[model samples]
Target chain A: MTSPTVFAAVGEVGKDFFKERTTDTLPCQSTDKLFCWDWARENFDRYETPLRQHVELVLISVAIGFAIAFALALLSHRHRWLRPPFLLGTGVLYTIPSIAFFFLLLPLTGRGRDTAIIALSAYTLQIIYRNTIIGLDNVSKSAVEAARGIGMTDRQILWKVEIPLARPEIFAGLQIATVSTVAIATLATFARGGGLGEPIFGGELGIDFKTNIIIAGGLAVLLAAAFGLLLLWLQRLVTPWRRVETE
Target chain B: MSGLLSQLPFASIDGAIEFIFEPQYSNVTGGNKVGGIDKVVELTINQLQVTVISLAIALAVALPFALYLGHKHKFETLAIAFGNAGRGIPELALIAFMAAAIGVGLLNVAIALAVLGIPPILTNTFVGIHQVDRAAVDAARGMGMTEFEILRKVEIPLAIPTLMGGIRGATIAIVATATIAPLAGYETLGDFIINENVYGENGVLAGAILVALLALALELALAGIQRLLTSPGLKPRPA
Candidate 1:
């Protein structure tokens, strides 16, 4: 609630404020300085930091979401009553819409990374929880029986047998979560967590919209593409048997 | 509520309600409005309009291809790949790209929202059609039914529940994400949020609540439809 200060906006940005050069001002569209890429290159810090922040926000949110979802799944597995409630709650949370959820959190947490993470991570829970539960549930009964017959405890059987078998499904959930989280993290700037929203928002704010929008939007897409591939590789490495099974 | 503070005029739950239900009054600074999409009710309608248009276009593009592919048991990879790609791309980026490349308007917002809706419907249509009981389809085929008849009579009825799930999921996503339409230079509930400084804190919170409520209502209403459409025998027992 900084009162939407014109001063602060100017404090960060110069008085020429809006993209100083435009096609209207210039002789030709080609020579338009309003959205010059060279300006973006010169003032790269303004955008680069936001991009990095976007990446880190996604990484942190997903990690936190994974841990929480994993714990919830294990709990619900042990206590049947918790499963339905956990799933239902997370499903409702998922439907809360990221922008609304983030703003709703603004009152309780004010603005920043904490509020952003809370909302972003909630989006991951249903995916992670459902996948983990399915994976663990799908573990072969015979495998568990064999483990028990070998004098292994239930806990040991879960860790040694069920979890390993469930790796692929869990990782699939992670992949989905990672992708969605990265995408959703773009709105974190509005929530005060600072991400790639700078240019997109600034574009709407009538700045050097074309250049800023392209760079910002392009970076966001590239981040998502990179993460999708990264997680796919990681999933493959963790679940090597999956390749054989599919083949 | 930060809006409740003395420094800000529009700062109470009553203020929020009035601000939402009544948009004429304003004490926001500088009179610097963004997008000028005033009125909460107007915003809500705009949000719904954008969502419905997006959904219609998405289903048109995705449903037929998915159904044909599912029935043929071919090119299943296409739907899956599309779904994955859609999941990875943010609506924000898409909207920004559209605004930058194609310029902004209602159509641009719908196009952006359509991208958000397509993946779920495409993947689900393929899966739902595929998941139809093999025995029933075989029996229908043995009864000398045409391929079209078997698909229409046997596969579609059985696949309705799953297909509805896809529709519901897509509808929900689009409805929720449509709130950001204001950012794309289109009128939406997000107008309150994107221009919160002008509307003040209560206006933003009120806008957020309304958006959340709308999305929830859509979710519940769609779930109800899904349940009702599920064949009696196919409906899962409540645990």
Candidate 2:
């Protein structure tokens, strides 16, 4: 059969399947009622609660991960023996499959948000740690020497000089980690507290195509715009000097 | 350091090896023992296959687009915006959408991964090519090279390190993300981990170690590739 004919046949098959499955005990009335914007408006709290929790999970994990990564980066910079293994290990952690990581944690921690947080936090380590190291590495040797010559203590040099200079790279890492954290949190839906993944999975289980498409597509657009704006704001905050330098 | 290391919980390499290779420890779904070495090996290979295929697709699509966007000022802003959007959307959501639209299986997973993998590659490609020394490009053009020739012979070689860096990042991301493939019912190492969790077994720790090992192996391999690609004569030195 031609492609259009094939699609039509598939659509009919899907319709028939839905019809067969439809029963008096079906949850949430008919699928048609669920599609209405008014229905979503009325049940906004149900959706919003999960969305907020997912966001909270992502933010907290990222905050904690960034703190750990920053400390590791500092320690790695000072101790030559620690650098290689630390970099290599974090790189590996960053690369491990999120699902595998979550599952691995799940046995110990069980299902739900905590496991998801730990998994996502582990994933963020490489980006934040590597970027922190790279940012410090990229700091001009002369700057460090100058600080030392001026009698700045090691801690003072790091907090006052190196970190300020490394802010841009750190922000870049934050941008990456934040975006990644948001994306991965959608998988938290698997543990049952529904996020954007709910509709997509619902669609897979033969729920309404339009509903799933709307939820997934709308969420994608919202996330992309929001994060992009966030990066812009962060850039402005961290590197106000950028504007002056360019000007 | 020795005291600290000893104090912390440490699983020996030998223990890991034994757990991975002994048949008695192998627990497949349906309460069957599939044997350890074979199960772990199969799962590793499965993940490797998915990562490589997805990375290949990402590189192929991202490179040319990056080149095109780099050269054309009119399209630059739009290209960057597109990449930013791609970077923002979570891979899990993208995978779910793809699975919903195309139905589940390997191809859907690959396509979803490729989508997730594209932005980094594209952004890096554009940045790499744009950062190619102007003098080199001018000299190439002065030598009567066509636009295509300059890009192929002059710009790309210089940009390879940055491009490779992006590919390295993309490869790592895809390999890590591909672990989620089991969620959609495709059998991968993630299946072993997820299933072990469902059954309340010791396999979870084994699965974690396996994933860690695989990720370490992938990072080493990619670093090796990056080193080879960025050798002295092949690309410009890092500025």
Candidate 3:
């Protein structure tokens, strides 16, 4: 409508592209260097709370997910008709994206760690449940038959024979769930849950700061790897027969 | 709990539904009408565009390589490792890093999304083809089929379910990541979710609903395609 209006429109459009996030007082940050070691050294302490939050989010989510999924798997294994419905329910939960899931629960759960953990745990349900069921199904029929011949009860057979044999697949599911939770928990920031995503999404220096992105992103990757390795080690410890078989 | 729920912001299910169907006046937009079916449809199309392009690129790149590896029975560890590593790369970080470093647009966002798609496809394809019955391949070979023909007519057919599983996983990941494409300046369905200042809370809820539906629909469509492509004989018969 006017010259001032046109200029203002142009400035609004170009601001994200043209504006410098940092002042020239800091040479590395102002120059838009790929990674500023000096800036990182100074600002690295800010990532501590976010990193801790990220770890807690992943751990709590995966733990709750594994519990629910494992219980469901056992229940469905006994009641054959429940299997399909359980699978469908968890599949729907899994289908919803983490970001959307966060918001969909916003009204009910409110924005916080509780909302994030619920969504993240829900996402894990399908994967872990499916794997656990598959693991149970894949147990050798002969072992069950032998246990029956020995006059073992159905519960006893399931606990002793089927579950023991299903260890590898069950542990595999746990590993996958843990790793995925580690990655997705970074989005917990959207729910005001606070995680590594806070730093990447411009906690202090803003998203334009490559150094911040590198530190936050790298920590997430490292966290995933750490959880993955920890799960693998735990798996080996719990499944002594697996070690023997591999050896 | 009900009392707590009533006190929360943006908890209006009815309001979100109305926001999806009709533009509403927004104080954030200075009383300008924002969101509605038209804006939702436009953004949904943009989201689907990025998702489809990224998936196509991922399939084109990962399929051949995975198939070759499966056929040769080589580099099993490498294929499997990629699957593990890929799962660990946080989607939020990947997109933010891409936007910050490589600059953002449809292409950049698509590429970032594709990076998420490739590993699942590669791992599933390799495992699927590798696990195909050796007898089936030998029979195809005995019928004077070339290696390529055997792969096309026998191996791929047998591996359809597993291959489709991978594609479904990739589709889910790509579609989910595409919801964040607005951060990269691509104006996907995430625009409503991200620019809450203009679109308001109702639009945010609507965006979430639409994204969830879109993902489920894509998954269902892929599952249908997988079933259609599979040979009739391979279909499980009821006792």
Candidate 4:
């Protein structure tokens, strides 16, 4: 009842915007209840770890996906016949459901970030690989001839001429990979790698936690949109010639 | 032989086949209660129901709307926005989100799958109809055909292959997604893996392979349909 006790109570009350997750003890295991925040509270800045980890997972997956896809596409481009089978193999990989894909990798890698990355990269491979192949094929033949006439070696022609011309398509593929990976990495929760979906499947909060679900789901959508816009900006930066061609 | 195969660290090819074929006769019921061939067939059918019903719903709604949009030459910006937004949400995320709103059940899972199916079909159909030769449409118009008739007679035929591209894409994607239907309280091939207590390690491995095989089979079937649907003259020359 003294001044010191009053001050401590006020500070604790104000600390978490709402009470910490343990505030509510819902005994109702019944699914009939409306989605209520009685059991849930979002401390606004509590999402920092999930946000950082989600972004990291997405960037790493897309980076690895683009590199692997580029190599495969390049190999196929050189051999010509390898393109069909390469496309077929990756297409089959894409057709595997993301959850099932995770389980398939679970035994090999066990759990956590690496397993999530491998599965997500598998999903990204087909899109980037196909786009890379298209980008290379679309490089103007005359441009390749022009590069050769300038005494460029085969590797130099690819590095200097074809890849530069193909930048937009390759970047476009990266954009797709980035956005989708951000979205998919949310489910990295299932792989024991926590992300936005931690609250989404409701976990400790239970499925009926309204505020938590909104915060998590809304963040996931926002993450995807922000990442997508960043890619679009990067694409514009990397492909200034595209603007010239279009306008 | 099956016992030996199961003891292997990971699932072997022989294990998957034997699990599928032998479980019906043998005493090898997984903890998931997936007894044998009858159960496998049942789960397969359940998976198909989710896939087929959801796909049908998505196609029914998206196709007509896309064709109409193409006919009117409207909603191009909206279509592009929808496509981008749709691609940004993973199938698992969509399914879980729907489960929250509707509660978990077979119908809820099917609705989730349907939402997954819509964007590709809508995007592809819109692009397809838009890509039809303008001169042909102008000629058909000049011949006094109504807008609807022009769309049907001129645009729809030419646009079939591209429209089917959307269908093929959606079908394959939905079939894959349907594998998770069991996790949301609907029984499907995923039960083999999702109910870890029931199927244990062998179920998980065999289920993964079965789902993959089912998807590949669907892809092959859809590709064949895509070929059949493509106009013979539109088929590219052998390279």
Candidate 5:
């Protein structure tokens, strides 16, 4: 994916960029110096790399998780026994601690962004799967019967009737998973994958309290705004009928 | 299931208990021993303490905000947006932020978890209260009940199921996520798992399994609580 490429390129360049531009170029000794537009401009080259990396991590992980969830939802619908086991397994996976899950995978997978993506994707499975099932189930039984009465095949019924009906719920689930993926992707910093978390974690380790606070708070606001907007856009796109229905 | 349990290192409940309490005596068939049993027990208790305390604080603080939001049309949009934003931020980042600001410890962990925990509780409380039969609320008001009395007598009871459901969901999420607390140097069951992983020990699997079992047990207990809380009054009325 372009996400992984962007992430890798960013990480490779970030440290060098930070060292060159930020090492001895301080206008003030106070932590507030870091927040100045001049300081930002000087450090912008350094910051761009990690920002790209963070975005890529969120995007790639959400994409992978969404694909897996879609496939699982489809298969579970196809087979009865599979549904229960899949639900049970994903439920347990969802409950597993993300940090622990990442650490567990780290030894086997070795440290990097991929481990974080895999762990977050596993966590996404439960919410997405449950919502998908509910969405599919909510497709009116009468509609299915009518489709069959009209001699439509099962696939046709699914494509034309079931999917459209289920899209809202499914999209709601996706919105949730997307936001969660973005948030959790920040933790990928622990494995040296560089994100906004890099600044947060770096500040923590360096005992630079001000930097840590600023980065963490700034990231939170940014994530909230970005995800909030994305969710609104998604709701508008996938559930336009909702507006119509309410009207 | 019993056979599967038997194959596990600490199969029996008593055996698990003993293993947790007295790690020195516990046989180490695996290469990894992250810490003694007492450490695991202490960590588990610590995590539980953090989770419960934070949840209580969240509910306490959020309930009134929820009630206020439920009553005020102007605040509803703001409340919903705040809740959504709250849910959107990653728990880890919040924890990291808290740890960074306050220094790493239990309080920081609790604050972070509480922040993450509030939106669900608040939103659910507002939703549950709002979903109450409007007529019932009106009747209470007509009967000369004060606003507070109406809220207490009519709205809260109707909202209990949904409020409990939100609490249940939040509890599960918190318990599972609390393992992250260890990263900030606060001990939890995650300590064993993370430590085992770092040192190349087979114990990571066992630690993971134990944490998973702990989560399952908590979930089952909460489900039972939900059922009890929501069941008795849920029967249909006669036509």
Candidate 6:
């Protein structure tokens, strides 16, 4: 965690470790300055690990959330009666804020990535589960009838026909979940989950550092966009029929 | 297992309950009394204040623009993109950035949060209004209704569910983010969570409990409001 010394020629930003400065002031030293290029260039390396960690947190949380929500959605689909209760249960989980969520789980889960993952994943449940149900529900009656005419069993019809038909809406849910997770995972630093939030929330400089906030915040936004587009692309690839419909 | 559980300060759930209902001595401030129902009420009020203000601002700004756009059926892509972009914004960063760059105050925090509130309202309102049955709109027009009358009497009523969904989303986002408004120097329920040094473990748990309850309450209240606003004709019937 040592400061970078490579930018010695430009300014001594990395060298000063919160020590009281003398009369000399760099643009980065001034808190009022919107952004300082020199400071950002020097401190660019600081965000690398946190950025990767942020990605990991978002991906893992969404993956876990999708798995659980998918299973629940399937169970609800079969029983039908379980839908309302499952929806209400996940809705309650979704309503709780992550900051509060972190502390709520502190006693049982303790602090760290596991607690962060649990909370973050829990947040995704309502959106994912609801969307999956909606998608499955929207599967055309005639398509199911046609499949049944071919003597396909209930399990086969669900896996082969309904799921494939529901792919776009399922992907839509995943897109929203993944994108939002990117933003929320930044709060994981509160649980010591360590993401880009570490810097934004007073990691090296301080929370008040505009430069750090912009960098970390910007990275999160970019991460969300990248994930969003990737999901959109995957949705298109998986559901080629959707493209034909648009055309 | 019992010993380890006992060692954790927040393990005893009653300690958190007591923290909410009764003030406790804080060693960090040289044995000062802290927390209690009064403190919780104050912080919750602060949180609600910010959330209400932000949602109002978001509604005031987004409602008109989205309604106009939806009525016109223009800028569909822009509305959708705006909603998507809004979700992409990290709440922590927005609050911290506003505090650091914009300077901290209730107004600043509200504005920061309203930024979070706008897109959902805009996109949902737009979609809601845009998706209203064209036949109803035309039938209203054929009944000698003006364009404005048609929108007011027909479009808005049909769009209430979607519009209210947006409002509910905005409320949830605003209230959740308000929990962290203390970071922007606006003391809300988050003060207990953020300043753990002062409030300690029980206080943190208390804050979490209060926040969860507050969110649930707000959601339920909004759901009730949505039901009231929805047109009678649009209500779902039993199969």
Task: Please give the CA lDDT of all the candidate structures.
Answer: 0.77, 0.69, 0.86, 0.75, 0.67, 0.87
- Model 6 alpha-carbon miss at residue A118, Å: 0.2
- B52-134, model 2: which lDDT tens digit per residue? 88888998898888997775533666666666566566666565445544456666577688887898899878988888888
**lDDT per residue as tens, model 3, B1-239:** 54555466656577778899999998777778999999989999999999999999999999999999998889998999889888998998898877776667777788899999999999999999999999989999999999999899889899999999999999999999898887777888888887777877777787888999999999899889998998999999888
Interface RMSD after interface superposition, model 4 = 12.0
Candidate 5 residues A186-246, lDDT tens each? 6676555666666665433342333443555466458656865876787778767788988
For candidate 3, list the clashing residue pairs, or say none.
none
Which ten-residue region of model 5 chain A has the weakest summed lDDT? Answer: A1-10
Query: Residue by residue across B1-239, what tens digits does model 6's lDDT show?
Result: 54565467553457778889999998698877899999999998999999999999999999999999999999999999899878889999999987765567688889899999999999999999999999999999999999999889999999999999899988998999998898888899999888888988888888888999999999999999998888888899887
- DockQ (C-alpha based) per candidate is 0.32, 0.31, 0.42, 0.27, 0.23, 0.48
- The reply for model 2, stretches above 4 Å from the true place, is A1-39, A76-82, A106-112, A137-157, A189-224, B1-45, B71-81, B195-200, B203-208, B234-239
The TM-score between candidate 6 and the true structure equals: 0.93
Candidates, ranked, lDDT: 6, 3, 1, 4, 2, 5
Between candidates 3 and 4, the lDDT winner: 3
For model 3, what is the error of residue B220's alpha carbon versus the real structure, in angstroms, after optimal superposition? Answer: 1.1
lDDT score for residue A48 of model 3: 95
Indicate the worst ten consecutive residues by lDDT in candidate 4 chain B: B24-33
In model 1, the Cα lDDT at residue B181 comes to 78
Greater lDDT among 4 and 5 belongs to 4
Error of 6 at B211 (Å): 0.6
Of the candidates numbered 2 and 3, which has the greater DockQ value? 3
- Number of clashing pairs per prediction, in order: 1, 1, 0, 3, 0, 0
Q: State the lDDT of candidate 1 residue by residue for B1-36, as single tens digits.
A: 445542443344555566665543446655543323
Q: What is the TM-score of chain A in candidate 2?
A: 0.79
Instruction: Report fnat for all candidates as fractions from 0 to 1.
Output: 0.46, 0.37, 0.63, 0.29, 0.26, 0.63
Tell me the deviation in Å of residue B95 in model 2: 1.8
